[model samples]
Target: MISTHLRLSALSLAMLAATPFAHAQTQTPRQSGDGAYLLETVEVQSSADASRDGLSQPFAGGQVAEGGQVGILGTQAVMDTPYSFTSYTELLIEDQQAASVGEILLNDPAVRVARGFGNYQQVYIVRGLPVFSDDMTYNGLYGLLPRQYLSSSFIERVQVFRGANTFLKGAAPGGSGLGGAVNVVPKRAPNDPMTQLTVGGQTGGHGHAAADIARRTDDGRFGIRLNAARRSGDMAIEGESSALSMAHIGVDYRGDALRVSADLGYQDHRVDGGQPNITIDGGVPIPDAPDATKSIGQSWTYSDSEDLFGTLRAEYDFASNVTGWAAFGARTSDESSIFANPTVTNVNGDYTASRFDTAREDTVVTGETGVRVRFDTGGIDHTVSLSGSVYDLESKNAYAFGAPAFSGNIYSPAPVALAPNTVPGGNLSDPGRTIHTYFQSVALADQLKMLDERLLVTLGVRYQRLKDYNYDYNTGNRDTNFSYDEDALTPTVGILYKLTPTVSMYANYIEGLQKGARAGNTAANVGQTLDPYETKQSELGVKYDGGRLGGSVAVYRSRKPVAGQDANNIFKIVDHQKNTGLELMAYGQITPTMTVLGGISFLDADVDGDKAIGAPETQANVNLEYRVPQWQDVTFDGRVIYTSSQYADAGNQQKVDAWTRLDLGARYLVPLANGTLLTLRGRVENVTGEDYWASSGGYPNAGYLTVGAPRTLLLSATFDF
Candidate 1:
C-alpha cells in the first residue's frame, strides 16, 4: 500500500508552488474640499460571494440555480458569469428520487447519459462531445469520484458547466472533457439540525434504505453530517440483480476568520446478468429494440467496483478583501469484473461473444491552493486570483480475453457456458502498474468591473505541465523505456454586459488542453505516443430574470482534435471535430402554483469530412410541476424529452431512430408534531413503455448502442426529524 504520508507531501508541494500575479493601480481616491472624500472605498470581502458557496438559494422553481462553481474563480452568480451553466440542488435530487448522477442529468437539453464501452461506467455527452466519468471533478479537484457509478445520495449538488473549461478548471486528468465539465458538491450541515430516514423500492422488487443525519453546534461554528445508503435485489431486467452500498461523512468549521471542511465517502457497487451494449458490423441495418427488460447476458457475467475517497479544504481570511485557501483530496479504487458483451454480425442482432476478465487499481492525489484579492485602480474594480494545482494518478490494470466463441440473438437468446480465458494480459487477481499521470498547472486571473459595475471582463491564463508513463503489464518496467512530457499555456477571456437591471449579455473565448492518444495494440505504430493538443470554444449569450421567471439564449462553437491513422497507417492528431449549436432554456415559477423547467438545443457537427456520431441535430426537454391550490403539500410533475435521429457510425451509414420519452411524478409532505416531517415521492419513467435505442457509443470514438430503459417505477418515503 502507498504511504498516506506521500499524499500529504504532494499537497504541501502544490500549496507552496508559486504562480504569477498581476495588477495595476490606476484609480486613487482624491481629497475634496471641506474634508469630504471624492470617492468612498468599496470593500470586497474575501469570503467570496455567499451564493458561490452552495446551491442553497433556488432561482424560482427549485429545479436549478443562478450560480455554481466556476473553476478557480470559485462560485460566481450565473448572471455575472460569461459561461452557460446550471447547478441542481439537493432538493431536486431527493424529489426526483434520482439513483445516480446519470439519472439526474436527464433533465438537461444539451446533455445525454449512456453506458461505458463494455462496463457499467456512466458516460456523459455534453455539447456533442463525450465527458467520461473519470474526468468529472469532486468539488474543484480531479480524479476522486468513482469511475463507474456515483450515487446521488453522496452529493449535495450537481454543477454542470457547458463549454471548454481547461483554462478555468485545468485540463482533466483523464485527458477528456473537451466539451464541458461536471462537479459534485458534497453535503454540508445546515444551520438547523436535520435528520432524515428514507425507504424506497423500484420495479423488479429492488429495495433501498438510506439515512441522512446532521448536527451543528449551538454556535453554528462547528458541524458534522453522516449519510448512508444500501440498495439490493432484482432490477427491471429479467434475471438481473444488482447491489450498491454507500456511506459519507462531512465535517466543517466556521470561525471568525477561517473556514475548514472535510468529507469522506465510500461506495461499493455490483451488477449481475445485466444486458450490455451490442456492437454492429459491416454497415448492417440497425435492428429494432426488443423487450427492454430482456437480458441476453450470461448468468456468470458480473462486475464489482469499490472506491474510498476524502477531501479536506480550508480558507483563511486575512482581511475583508484578501483570502487564502488550500484543499487536498485523494482516492483509492479497486475493481474486478467478468464481461461478455457481444458483437452483432447481422441485421437481426445475431452476435458472437467471448469471455473477458479484468482487474484494476487506482491511487490518486490532488490539491489546490490560491489567494483572492480585490482592489480598485482609478474607477475600475478588480478581483485578482492566483492559484496552483496538481493532479497525480497511478493506475494498475490487467485483462484476459477469449476470442468470440459463442453466438446469440438480441431479440431472442440464451446464455451459454463461459469460455476459458486463453489470453491473460496479466494476473487478473492482482494487476501490476500499467500507467501513471502527473499533471500540474498554475493559473492567474483578474475580474475587472467597469462602467459602474455594469460591465465585467475576466482575463485568465493557465500554464500546465502534463506527463504520462506507461509500464508493461507483467513487469513494472516502462512500456517503451520512455515517458511522455508536454506543456501548454491556455488562456480565457470573458465579458458580461448588463443591458438592463434584470438582463445581461455575455461572451467568452477559451481553450482546453488534452493529453495525446496512444496507438493501440492493433495499430501498426502500437506503443507510439502522439503530441498533445487543445480544444477551442467561443460563445455568446443573453439572460433575463423576471423575478419568478428566468431564461437564457446562447450560441456557441467548439472544436476538438482526436486521433486517426494516415494513409500510410501512421497515427497522428490530424483528425478533428467541430460542433456549433444554439440553446434556449427557461426555468422559474410562472405562477404561484405552477413551475416549469425546459430547454431546446440544436447542433451541427462534423468529424474530419463526415458527420459526427452521437450528436443528434436536435434535442428538447420540458418539465412542469403544479401544486394544488387546495392542498398546499401536494405536488405533481411531468417531463418529456425528444432526441433527433443520430448516426450509429461516423460514416453516417447506420442511424438510430429519433426517440422521445415521458415521465410523471408526484410528491407530498406532511408536517408532524415536535419538528418532525414526512415526505412521500413517486415517479414513473417511459410511462408508455417506449422501447428504442437510446444512444450510440459512450466511450470516446466508438459506436455501440444501448437500449432505452423500459417502464420503470420508483417510490420513496422519507421522515425528517
Candidate 2:
C-alpha cells in the first residue's frame, strides 16, 4: 500500500520532471472576471482534442491527467487531457422536465438506450460498445454497479465519457465493459436555503409528490441537503402499476484551505413487471397485443432495495505551492426480487389456476479512495493521481414449490392476464442457493504540460483481482471457487496547437481494457475466463470559440471487442470489434435572447461484427431555446432527433428502420403578491406523434419496441418562498 506521504512526494517529483518541457509550450490567453481563477473552464479545439482555461484553480497532484473540462460531481475542472466526453447540467434536466434518466438521455445522439423490463430499466450503448451496469463510474470513480431497476428522481445530472478508459478507471468485475462508462452526479448541498414541494400526476393515473430541502453558509464553506419522493400509479401499459419511495441526505464543507463532504441515501420499490410486451398479426408494435392479451394474464412481481452510502473528502494546500486532495466512500445495497407466475386459463379454456414463485436476493458492498496533487514546474504545469478500491457481492435465488406453471404461451395476450384475483405470491428466499464474489483494484497515473502550455502527455496503469464462489441449487452443495488477477498499462497522447486566440485543432490516441469471469458454464468452458479485452480509439477534431457560440466536430475510429464468444459459444478476447464515426456539438447563444445546444453522432460500428447488433450507423439531434426579450421572462424550447436503421434482434433476423421525432415546450415566470416568484411550464412531447423504435427486438420476439410516448401534455406551476 502506498502511504499518503509517499503519494504527495511522488506528485512533487512528477512536477519537477515536467518542468523542463513546460518552457517549450507557448502561453495561451487568459480571461478576467469575478472569481475567474476558481471557475474551471474547458474549450474543445476539435472533435477529439481540447484546451484548458489557464486561469482555473490549481488541481491536486496524482489526479488522472485530463484534457479540456473535467466534470466530476457536477463541478467543472479544466484539464488538457485527451478524451471525448460530455456533461449535462441540472438546468438542462429541469428545462426538459425529464421524468427519468432514460427520458433525459433520449436527446443525446451519441447514446443508445436498450429497453429492459419495458422502459423502467435500461442500459446505454456508446460508440458501438456495450456499457453494462457494472461499468458505471461516479465522480471519476466506481459507484453502484448492480443492475439498477429504479427511478432517477434524485440525480442531478449525468456525465458520458466515450472511447477506451482503461487507465482512468480500473477493470469491470463482471467482464462486461464493451463500450465506455457513464458517471452519475447526484445533487450536492446547496449554497442557499431552499424548500421545494411538488405534486403531479401522469396521464396513466400515476401521481407523485417530491420535497427538497437545502441550506448553505454564506461563504460557501458549509452546506446540507435532503431530498425525498414517492409515487404510485398505473403504468402506460394495461394491467401494469407501481409504487416507489426514495430519500437522500448529504453534508459538505468547502473552504480556501480545506474541504470535506459526505452523502447518504435509501430506497424502497414495488412494481408489476407486467407481462412481456409483444405484437401479433404483424401489426404496429403496440402494448396489450395478443401475447400479453392471451398468455396467462400479466404476472405481478415486487422488488425492495435498502441502501446506505457515505463519502469523505479532505484537501490541503502545502507551502510548496502544491495542493493535495483525498476522497473515500463506502456503499452497501441489499435487494430482493419476487416473481409470480399464475395460470390464467386451463388448456380447455376453463378458468383454472396454478401459481409458481421465485425470489432473488443480492447484496453488494464497495469502498474506494483516490488522491491527487498538482503544482507549477518552472513555467509549465504537472499533475498526478493514485487510486485503489475493493468491492464484494453475493446473490442468491430460490425456486418455490411446484416450478410455477411455465405453461402459458407468451404470444397469447389473453391467456396470461392476471391483474384480478392475482395468485398469492410467496418470497422464496433461499439461504442455501447463493453466489459470492470479491474484487480489488489499484490505479496510478501521471500527466505533464510543456511547450509554453501547447502540448500535454499522460500515462497510466491499473491492476485488478477477482474471486467468485457458488452454491448448487438442487444438491445444496458448494462449488469450488474462482479467482483471476490481471494488470494493464494504458497510454494517452495528444497535441493542441493554438491556431488563434479562439480556435484550436487537435488529435488523440487512447487505450482501455475490460476483463470477464467464468461461471455457470459447462465442463468444456468451466474454470475458463476470457482474456482481458482492449480497445483503442483515435480521433481528429476541431473546436472554435465564437465568443457567444462554442462548437466542435471530431472524426474517430474505435476498435472492436478484444475477446468474446463465437457461434460455438467459446470465449476469446482477440475478436476485436471496430467502429468509425463523426460527431459534432454546439452550445451557447445564437442571438441575444436565444440559446441553442445541440449535437449529432454518425457511426459505422459494425466492421467485423453483426451490423444489426451494434450502434446505428448514423444519428443526429438539434435543440433550440429562446427567451423572449420583449417579455423578459418567457422561454420556448424545442428539439428533433433522428437515427439510422439498426438490428432488431440478436439473431439479426429483423432490422429496425430509421426514425425521427419532435418535441416542444415553454416556461413563464411571473411575480406573485407575496414577493415570491411563480413559474409556469408546459410541454407537448411527440408533437408529431411519429412512432419509432428506440431499440432492437429479440428474436423469437420480432419487431422493435416503438418510441413516441403517445402525445403527452405536461403542465406545472412552481412558487419559491
Q: Write the per-residue lDDT of candidate 2 for residues 1-721, one digit (tens) a residue.
A: 1112122121122222221110111222222352111112222111100111211211121111112224211133322435666555545665576766556666677877664422234566677665654456544445453355435665654666766665566555554444566766556554335566666665467777777676666444566768888888775445556777888776666554565556666666666654332222232222221322112334445445555555555555553444455555555655554444322232232222233344556666666665556667787676666767777766666554333244444333344433322332333544444667676777766666777766665556667665656677555567653544455555566655546656667777766665554532643465676555567788887766566676678788877554445566665543545788888877667786677766888887563456636468888878888766666567788888787777644445445667677889998766545434456778877777554555553221233353324555666665544
Error of 2 at 607 (Å): 5.3
Error of 1 at 57 (Å): 2.0
CA lDDT scores, all candidates in order: 0.82, 0.54
Residue 580 accuracy (lDDT) in model 1 = 91
Q: Which regions of candidate 1 deviate over 4 angstroms?
A: 1-56, 519-528
Q: Write the per-residue lDDT of candidate 1 for residues 248-362, one digit (tens) a residue.
A: 9988776777788889999999999877877888589888877898887889999899999999988888889998899999999999999888788888778988888899999
Worst 10 residues of 2 by lDDT: 46-55
